[model samples]
Target: MTTGFETDRISRRKAIWREIPAGIWALGFVSLLMDVSSEMIHALLPVYMVTVLGTSALTVGMIEGVAEATASITKMFSGALSDWLGKRKLLAALGYGLAAFTKPIFPLAPSVGWLIAARFIDRIGKGIRGAPRDALVADISPAHLRGASFGLRQSLDTIGAFFGPLLAIALMWLTANQFSAVFWIAVIPGFLSFVLILVAVREPKRPEGLRRIRMPFSRSELGRLGAAYWWVVAVAAVFTLARFSEAFLVLRAQSIGLPLMLVPAVLVIMNIAYAISAYPVGVLSDRIDRVTVLIVGLFLLLAADLLLAFAPGAIGLVLGVVLWGLHMGFTQGLLATLIADAAPAELRGTAFGMFNLVTGLALLIASVTAGALWDATGPQGTFLAGAVFTLLTLIGLLPVQTRLGKREAS
Candidate 1:
C-alpha cells in the first residue's frame, strides 16, 4: 500500500516546468482553452435566458439541471469505458473536441431551445471526457508533488477562466453588443484543446490483468479503500448540493441592478480570485489532510450564502461572489486528488466516475431546487436554502473526522 505522499519522485524537467508531465500539463492547457470558451458563453447564458430568450427562472434552472445531468452520466460512463478500454487520451480528446465543435453552434442559436440543445451536446462531451482525464492525471502525477501537479494544472485551467470573460467583454465592446461573434470565436480554443490532447498527451496502456478483471462494475470487489471513498463521496454530494451554480449569482447580481455591461467584470473578478488561490491551496492540501481544505471551502460557501441572503448592494454581492471563487479554489482540485488517493489502482476511473455521477446529479437537483425556492420565496430564500444545507454539511463532518482520525491512528 504505497501512500500518495510516498510516491514523491519527480524528474528534473518536471521540476523546472519545462515539461511538467504531459498528462497533467495537458489538462491545464486544455482547460485554459475550454474555460476561455465556456466562460465566454456561460457567463452570458443566464442573461440570454432571462432577457433575450424570455425564459423564467424555473426554465433557466431546468436547462442547467438538464445540462448537469447530461454531464454526470456521460462522465461516469466515459470514465468506466476508459478504464475498461485501457485507453484515455483519445476519449478525452473526443470529449473536448465535441465540446469545441459545439462552440460555434451557440452563435447560431436563435431560441432558448436551440441554446439548450447546444448546452446538452457540450455537456455530453464534458461528461464523456472529464473523469478519464482526471484519472489520467492521478495515474501520472507522482505522489509527493501530487498537490503541485494538480495545483499547477488547476491554475492553468483557471487561467482560461480568468481570461475568458475579459475576452468576451472586449468582444462585446468591439462588436458593440454582438454576443454571437464572441461565441463563434470561442470555437477556436476548443479546437486547439482537441489538438493538444491528440498530439501532446499520451495515455499509458491499460494496466495488466485488466482482461481478467470484471467489466462494468463488481460491487462485491469494492476493496480496502471502498469505505473511506464512499464517505468522501457522500460528503462531496452534500457539497455539490450546497454549492449550486454561479448562474444564480449572476441572476442575483442582475436583480440588484448590476448593469449588463459590468457583468463581465464581475466574472473576471471572481475567476481571477479563483485562479490566484487554486495552486497555493492545492499544494497546501497535498501537505495537510485534503479534507481540511475541503472543509474550508464548505465554510466559505456557508458564509457566502449568508452574505448573498442579507447583503445590501453590489459591493456585498461582489464580495460574496469572490468568496464563492475562493471556495472553489480550496476544494475543486483537492477533491479530485482525494478521490484518487482513496481508490484502488485499477478502479480509480470508476471511483471518479461514480463520484462525478453522484455530484453532478446532485448539482442538477440543487440548481432546480434553488430556482424553485427562489420562485417560492425569492433570492433570499435560495440563499437561506443553501445556508441550511451548508450548516448541515458542516455538522455532518464531525463523524467523518472521527473515522478518518481513527483510521490514521490505527
Candidate 2:
C-alpha cells in the first residue's frame, strides 16, 4: 500500500502536470530537441577547430564569441518583430527552421571560414527563436507557476544538452572520431525540432480588435516596462560577463590530459548536474525570495571558478564542473522567470530581446578576454579572473536585492 507521504507526492506531481498548459509542454520538448541538435555540434566544435582546422585558442574564442553575439543582436529585431506582428509561434517556427537548414553546413564545410559562417547562421536561428519562445512560455503560464514552468523547460533542454554529448561520444567511437560524421547525425534532430514546434505549439490570441503593432518600444511601451525589468537585464548582463562560454571548459579538460573522444564527457557531466538541479531549484524560487536563490547561484559560480583555477587533477576538475552546472541550473531559469514577472505581457518579447542583447555583448567581450588571458597566463589565470568578476557581481547584488526585497514586500 502507498503511504500518505507517497500519495501526497503523487498528487502534487499530478497537480503540477495539470497546471502547466499543453503549449508549455510542447515548447519544452521543442527546446529539448533543438538543444540536442545544437549541443551535439557545440560539444565538439572547439576541439575540432583547434585540432583539425589548425586554429588557435584565441580563434576558437573569437568564433564562439562572435557567433553568440550575432544571435543576441538578431534577437533585438526578431523579438521586436514578434511583438509587432503579435505572433510568437510563427517567428519561433521560422527561427527553428532556419537553424535546421544550417545543420548541414557544419559537416559540409571544407574550411574554417565556412565553419564560422555555419556557426553564425546557427546562432541567428537561436537568436530569432530565443525571445519569442521565452515570451510564449510566459504568456501561456499562470503567474504563480511561472518559475516552475521556466524551470521545467530549462530542465528538459538541459536533458538534451547532456544527451547530445553522450550521443556524440558514441558516434565518435562508431566513426573513429570523424567529426563530420557525428555532425551528420545531428541534422535529423534539428529538423524534428522544427516540425514538432510547427505541428504541436499554438499561440494564444491577442486582445480583441488589437491594432497591428509595428514598433514595440515607443516611449509609452518603455514606461510600461518599468524599472524592475531593466534591473533584471542589468544583472543578467553582469552574470554573463562573469561566465564565459562553456567551450573553455572543454579546453581545460583537454589540456588536463583527457583524450579527444572523452572531451564530450566533460559537457555530459556538467549538463547532467544542470538537468538534475534546475527543476528543483526553480521550485525553490517560488517558495523563497528569488534574489536570495540567485545570490546562492552566484556564490556557486565563484566557488566553481576558484576550484577550477586551483584544481589539482581529474577529481578537482570534476568537482568544479559539477559546481558550474549547479550554478547554471540555479540561475538560468530564475533569471528568465524574473524577466517574465517584471515585464508587461505585451512587451515581454522585447524585454527578453534587450536582456539577451546586452548579455550577449558582455559574453563576446568576456570570451575574447578569457581567450587572451589563457594564451598569456594559462588556464589558472583565466579562471582566476572569472572569480574576480563573480566577486564583483556579488558585491553589486547587495543593494539591488535589498531594494527589490522592499518593493516585493510592499
Candidate 3:
C-alpha cells in the first residue's frame, strides 16, 4: 500500500523520533497527542471567549494570568515533591492524567468562570507533570546527548502543534464555529496522551550517590546551584516580556489584509520551522554548551521579534514566524539541559519546575502587559518592547555562557 516516498518518510521519522532514549521518544509521542488536544482548545480560546462567551480582553488576560501563574507555583511544588520522594515517572503520569481528566470540562463550561476553573485545573496538572517529565528525559539520556534528546522531544511536540491547528480549523469549518464541538473532540487526544504516557514510558534509576538528607544553605539548590539558574530565569523572563503570545502575530497578519482563513497556514509554517530545527539544534547543544546553542536560538528570536515589529506583508510575517519557531527549538530543550547541568540529578525535577514556573509566570505578566501596551500604543510598540527584553536577556546570559563554555571544555 505504500510508495517509495511513503516508505522513506516512515523510515526517516523512525530515526528522528529515536534521538532520545526510546522511552522519551514514547513520551514525545504522548506530548504530540496532548499538544494536539491542547491546541484544539487553546488556539481558539481567546476567540471563543470573546465571541461565544462574551468575555472581555481583560478577562481573557486575567484567565491566562491566573492559569499560568497557577502552573508555575504548582510546578515548583511538584518538582520538589518528586525530588523528595525520588520518583519521577509516577508524578509525571499523574500530572498528565489530571490534565486529561480536565479537558472535557472546557467544552461544557456555561460561563467564563467555568472556563477559568477548567483552565486552572489543566495548568495545575501541567505544572505538576512538566518538571518530572523533563527530569525523566534528562535522567535517561547521556550528558553529551542531552540537547539532542530534549530536542527530539521538542520536535515531536512541534509536530503536534502543526496537527492540532489543522484539526481545529477543519473542525471549525465543519462545525461552523461551534467551539464547544471542537472542545469535545479534543478530549480524545488528551486521553490518548495520558494513556500512552502510562503505557510507554519507564523511569530510570536516580543519579548515583544522591545525598538523602536535605542540604543546608551552602549545599541547597537555593544556594550554589540556585544563583545562575535564577539569573537565567530573570533573563528568560525578560525574553518572555519581549515575546508575548503568537495570537498577536495572527491578528497582525489578518489586520494587514491576509485572508482570515489563511492565518492558520501561517501557524502551520512556524510549526514546520520548529519541527525542522529542533532535532539538529538539540544535538548541537549536546556537543557544545547548552548556553551557546541557546544564545544562537535567542539571537534568532531577537531577529524574529524585530521582523514581526516592522513586518510589511505576508512574506515578512512568514519569515518572522519561521524565526520564532527556530527560537522554540533552541530554548525548549536547552532550558531542560541547563537545569540538568546546574542541579544534581536528585534535584532536577525542582530545577526544571522552578525554571518553568519563572518563565511561565513571566509569560503571564508579559501577555497581560503586552495587551495593555497594545491598547495604549499599538502592535508595533508591543513587539518593540519584546526586542528590548531580548537585548537584556542576552546581556544577563553572557556570564553563564562563559561558565557553560568552561563546563563543555571539561
lDDT of 2: 0.87
Residue 46, model 3: Cα distance from true site in angstroms? 4.1
Local accuracy of candidate 3 as per-residue lDDT tens digits, 1-410:
99999999788656654545788788889899999999889989999999888899988987887787888898888887787788889998998998999998988888888888889999988888988889888888877677778888889998998899889989999999888889999999999999998888988876578765253222555664555666666767777776788778787687678887787787788889889898888877766657777878888988998888897987888889899988987887777778787676667777787777778877877887887988888878887888888888888888877665555466
Residue 83 in candidate 1 has what lDDT?
Answer: 68
lDDT of 2 by residue, 1-410 (tens): 99999999889867876888888888989999998899889878998999998989999977876787789899988887888888888889999999999999989989999988889888899999999999999888887788888999999998998898778878999999999999999999999999999999988888676555656868877776777777777778878888998879999998899888677678789989999998878777887888889899999999999999998889988999999999999999999998887877778888888888888888878888999999999999999999988888777777667756655666
Q: What clash pairs does model 2 have?
A: none
Q: Which runs of model 1 end up more than 4 angstroms from their true locations?
A: 1-20, 43-64, 106-117, 205-212, 221-225, 399-410
* TM-scores of all predicted structures: 0.85, 0.88, 0.88
lDDT of each: 0.80, 0.87, 0.82
Which of the two, 1 or 3, has more TM-score? 3
Deviation from native of the Cα of residue 108 in model 3, angstroms: 3.9
TM-score, ranked from best to worst:
2, 3, 1
State each model's C-alpha RMSD to the native: 5.5, 3.0, 4.3
